[model samples]
Target: MTLEGALIRSEGLSIRHGGREVLRDVSFAIEAGEIVTVVGPNGSGKSTLLKALIGALPPAAGRVTRRAGLRLGYVPQGLRLDPSMPMTVGRFLNLPKRVAEEGRTRALAEAGAQGLEDRPLTALSGGQFQRVLLARALLDRPELLILDEPTTGLDQPGQAAFYQRLEDVRNSLGCAVLMVSHELHVVMSASDRVLCVNGHICCEGRPEVVAQAEEYRALFGTGTGGALALYRHEHSHRHDETCELDHTHGEDT
Candidate 1:
């Protein structure tokens, strides 16, 4: 991807944690008004990469650059709440800072939580809680939105609904979306691009292009379609084997 017009871009980025290198020589970019999904197996540094991009973890090498004065919104995997603490959804959004009623209303509405302002934080269902978290992220009307495994605990239908909400958020806010998700088949079917990372980027391209690759099709299925289809087959591949596909896109990428 071209870094010139990208909202955020990483150049030869490397990261380490607890004295072990987790990611190395990774580079990619997310442009405005686009949706990109990062996919990989467990312990592959997908979360670490997001943390590094958001400045939660410092890179061991290279750099992450953002456009001037860019406003970013981030939705984390989950939050630990004190069960004894009583707080309304609206009140929770104002924590560490406060926003006006108009902003809160708009954010909740955009997040598909229009009438949840008065609900207790602990009373929400899994899907409702996720929507609230999404609403919290949208409070800033960010130019870029980031989420880390946003649909982790949800079922198939819940996962599909959450992804649909993501599309709505991107359309309404006109912001670029960068997220880490285990729901690869669900998101890949709708994403503009996909990044397959295993500590480092093994390969990346438009979902259709990568899905159509004979190499991938032979192992993963014909394509990443129908949210539940990939569940029928096992998704296991040796990263070393597909690392060479990085150049497979070449001039087209």
Candidate 2:
């Protein structure tokens, strides 16, 4: 079921890695200005799904589609810089091409690393580095921003802060965001929708509802049932404008 104004969607998607099926029969769509998070246990094909959406992987079956000429920005999981080579944030953003000063500054400010242009990339803390990567991803003014486990090694507080900043960026840019993470608090509070995966999409729905799902509990354990309290955010308005149907459904991804 392809959505009328979907920014990106997958239909009966199946994928393989090294002769083994990693994802199967997955289907979902993300509309403009939506924040969708993909969560699952380790080796559950969370990252593989993201790769498939962004056209990095070929499907063994099914299809993935994007809006024609869609502008995309990607921040891969745990991007590391060689410490031996020194590079400033400003210099780094100019790589392969130069970005206008106004645009670069805006991207940096949106990511909450406003004065980091002069800082060495290697000198940044884990949180700061993630912000820089986010800033770089935002430089192209993407209509859909994709991330894979962007908060790999941040502390609890750092992870929370990054997700908050991500929300702010989404609002400012009015761009759809699709990210893969194990952050359950984000599933409950930050994301407009959630997809829980294990080989395939086990379940998907609204944050609080999915958090309490039996399938989610089975994969993540009951310990995460209470993680919803870690970050609490309420919506004054409903998501009907962007969500065609209630995502609190136990249907497809």
Candidate 3:
């Protein structure tokens, strides 16, 4: 997608954890107001790539370069709110940073967490917690927003509503979005571009284009709206001419 800025580029990014090579030669670019989704099977380093983009995990190889003064807002896989933390949703949103009451209210309203203002952080459900986190991220009015599996634990309705809210916020703010997700159909439908990663980038292109790639098939396999062919199929049968030949010899044929 065309953006005002130069680009957020990762040139040949790689990562290693405990001496194990997790991601290798990974690279991609995202632009302002663009939504990019990184998809792959479990343990394929999808989240690792996101973490690297946000500086949570430094790449063992390659580098991530972005525009100057690019404010980033991150929504991790899940919020780890302690049950003992005595904080309301409103107060929690302002932790370690100051935000005007109107701003907080507006953000929460946009994220559909308005009623949760007075509620304890622990009292919210998965969807509610995610919304509040999104609101918190919006408080900075960042130029870019990064989400890791942002739709996890939400029902179909909740997922749809969340995406609608995000779209509204993006339209008004004109901020770029980079989200990691497992909801294949939803991600493919919403993202501007798709980056398929399995230890490395299998393919990168528009959703339909990448989805049809041969590498996508080899990586995501048949479950991704394509042929169900796999590297190998397991079976318990063998029909060979060698066995028939042996049988004929034994039978004096």
Runs off by more than 4 Å, candidate 2: 184-188, 209-253
Report, for every candidate in turn, its global Cα lDDT versus the true structure. 0.77, 0.77, 0.72
TM-score of 1: 0.81
lDDT of 2 by residue, 1-253 (tens): 3398999999999999998999989999999888888876667798999989888899999999999988898898887788888999999888768999998999999999899999999899888889999999999999999988887898655665677678778888899999887653345255677776767776566665465766555544554324332222333333332232322321232
**Tens digits of per-residue lDDT for model 1, 187-237:** 435567778777787766555534455544554453234332121112244
Task: List candidate 1 stretches off by more than 4 Å.
Answer: 209-253
Listed in order, each prediction's TM-score against the native is 0.81, 0.79, 0.77
- Tens-digit lDDT track of model 3 for 6-73: 45778889999889998998867788778777765567788999888888889888999878888888
lDDT for model 1: 0.77
How displaced is residue 130 in candidate 3, in Å? 0.8
* Residue-level lDDT for 243 in candidate 2: 31
- The TM-score that candidate 3 achieves is 0.77
Residue 222 Cα positional deviation in candidate 1, in Å, after optimal superposition: 18
